[model samples]
Target: MKEDIENTSDSLKETRNVFIGAKVTPTQKEHIKSLAGQCGMTVSDYILSRAYNFKPKARLTKEEAALLQNLDDCRSDLVKYISALHGMSTKQRMVMFN
Candidate 1:
């Protein structure tokens, strides 16, 4: 894990002297910019990633992220409750206990 992190940091800092260029219309430029923004990436990074045969994941909106967190919390709670229930005997789970 540490090695992976170091490699990623090194790659991020790698300098590029070469230039890649393409001509696109105004509408295409706007669309590409919008896509890059959704993925939380700069235009160059976005274009470079696509060139590398991979798509960058779009960033989640605040509400979407919050909902995912809430669902994860609920799933954790459910797991705990299920494990506790599984530890109980059928008699112990009776609803009409004296």
Candidate 2:
């Protein structure tokens, strides 16, 4: 519907222009470049699209939203575990490991 499309469009704010550096192996860069070309999006756009899974016109049902939230929480837990194993302080570490 037109109203849904308009609402979706309004929700997405324009990305700010900023510089962020990433260190990637040559192979990774080449793969990203090739995929970006195939998808007809710039390398940055392609990467961003995959990372955000952005679709201007797509909508999430309530069940999908709940699943997404659960996945996000799992990701957070994984990050905490990785951090604890690396160098994060014991005090800041989560008790889930216990």
lDDT of each: 0.88, 0.73
Number of backbone collisions per candidate: 0, 0
Q: What lDDT tens digits, residue by residue, belong to model 2 across residues 1-98? A: 75575567568864547866689999999987877776667888777666556632335657988999999999999999787677856654565456
Estimated TM-score for each candidate: 0.68, 0.40
What is the lDDT, from 0 to 100, of the residue 46 in candidate 2? 75
- What is the per-residue lDDT of model 1 for residues 1-91, given as tens digits with 9 covering 90 to 100? 7567558868899676789889999999999999999999999989977865678999999999999999999999999988987898888
lDDT at 62, model 2 = 74
Best by TM-score: 1
Worst 10 residues of 2 by lDDT: 51-60
Question: Which residue pairs show collisions in model 1?
Answer: none
